[model samples]
Target: MSGRKFAMKKTKSRRKKWASSQLFYEYSTFFRKNADNVIFQVTSDQLPTLNRIGLDDLFMSKGHIREPHWHPNAAELDYVVTGEVVIGMVDPIRHHLLQFHVTPSQVVFIPINWWHWITAVSDDVHVVQVFSSAKRQIIEGSNVLRKTPPKVFQQSYDVNAKQFASLVSPIKETVVIGPPDRYALTNLSDEHPESVPRVVNHTPPGSPNLFFDLKRNLAVRRDHSYLYEVTSTQIPMMNVLSLGDLYLTMGHVREPHWHPNADELDYVISGEVTVSILDPNTLAVCNYRLKPGQVTLIPKGWLHWIIPYTEDAHMLVYFNDGKIESVEGSDILRLTPADVFQRAYDIHAREFTREISSITGTLMIGPPDRPRR
Candidate 1:
């Protein structure tokens, strides 16, 4: 009785401390709107539990661009949720300008500090950009162009000082989305040989694969539950970030497991789910019920599981490492000797062995058979 009382007291104390740890955030509430385009961000500042990971929920209309920019502190993995986009980036190492036309379910990865920009190809373009750092620091090209003296352009690149100044005069401030709202929209399809660079099929030797289609790669499928994953193995350019697109029906559970090499951020796309994480620091189980547009962060190596509360629950799970390594609870139970468990916990060895005999391999989803519930 004394031991149980002490344990209860300890749990109460830990709960007090854990109460301050925020694990959920709504992306819709805190967003930056630029005319018709909107950018919703979730970083450590918004979700205090976030560590070494963040996301930007981008929305743009046709012909608009997510202005030329680069993240100095984080590598980015951009996944197209709807419509189409043309992702352009300058490879710093090779000094080559690379561009990829991405469609729905496709993704483009940008290495850290690489200058990149996204232009909407179809109307209502939606892209989810995941970052390696909790707080991604960006340097916008508009600021660089508008802030730098015209004389510097002439001195550095041999451009006419007055012409450069006049060209950039319209850029009044940081243009998150371009061309600024004040400027009339132009026909992007109109070809201007002088201004538009010709598209070429140039593949340099040893170039990394930056673009991938998640829909083309299905990791696993069981009944109504399915998982699609993109990792370094799929896209070599991906270094610090990967994604797992998961769907589950009611009674389905993303079985208890822990990523040994990466931290996970779960963003709900539809329906509802309960993300349960075992806090290593507090040794307490914390469960967060999430709905669409909500997110939860799970630290690396923390035992966690997900159970869908409603049918059609879809989640986008982002990891800090390109190569994800997980230790499944099913694997642990199946691999461990029954005698070892019996010796440690003073249980019936033969009964334990018989109980776990059905678990032959890794069960990413619980209940090998259909759930009666």
Candidate 2:
């Protein structure tokens, strides 16, 4: 009776925990909207299972800019999903300004505490920014420019206090998407060229390469599925964030695996997919069916796999570690001695060995095609 009661208690506890675990979120319903620009965010606040990883879906129109800002606690990996943008950042080590023109399927890395900004170069631009922290803290340039007293500017730079005050007066609030709608525009020629910081189009030697083209670098290509990845190996500038662009068709599976060092957030771009995760604590398997604009989070070291339900499923997987180290399920089954399996489960050793002989390597995507008898 005691054993039966303990089993029932455990089952009840598992049900309670599963009921509270949130593995799916919709981006379309939860977003911060600006006039012509918008941002959708996913952090620990929204998904309790998230660990040291977050994402922001940002959209901007031509000539608009995502105001200059610096994240105090996170490194950012920006992946361009559509259109083009110019990413500008100030290198603190060299005190140089660097700019890169990024188009669709490209990426730019911004180190933690680096001042950076983005300007849309095309009509419709969508960039997904992945952060290393669950809750990324930001300090906007508008706050710095508006909050500082004009007298301090005059004292430091020897500028007219009244003129400086007038110039910044229009910035009443945090202008996330700039040129504030009420602000007037004026074209003025550069009168003090020497004062302007020289902008460089290319990175200096010995400096981290900040730009990479994901489409050009295909990590894996199969008949029905393909993946593109970006990590510290590809761009040393990537501090603690990495990305994988994945596309899988119906009947295709992202083979079961576990990341030993990094947490994962999967964001669906098109079609539908089902993500399965096995919780180590409760020994329960949870399955989440996600559609376009939906997302799921998998904690570090958790066993998981993805299967597509539609013909053209696309998703982006983000990780908190720049170098993702994973252990594939196929490797474990194929490498384990048949005798060990027999000893553990009382199975026929020879049959187990023969059954797994076909799995000679890491099968990232499975069911190897075999001729039907």
How many residue pairs clash (N, CA or C atoms closer than 3 angstroms) in each of the candidate models, in the order given?
0, 0
Whole-model lDDT, model 2: 0.78
Model 2, residue 363: C-alpha shift (Å): 1.5
Query: Largest lDDT belongs to which candidate?
Result: 1
Could you tell me the C-alpha RMSD of candidate 2 in Å? Answer: 8.8
Residue 35 lDDT, candidate 2, scale 0-100:
34
Candidate 2 weakest ten by summed lDDT: 6-15
lDDT of 1 at 364: 89
**Tens digit of lDDT per residue, candidate 1, span 193-264?**
322234443446656778888988887777889889999999877878999999999877999999988889
Residue range 186-277, candidate 2, lDDT tens digits:
22114433322334458876567898889877877667788899999999768588889999988779999999998889987767788898
Cα lDDT, model 1, residue 2: 20
Model 1 pairs in collision: none
| All candidates: TM-score | 0.88, 0.87
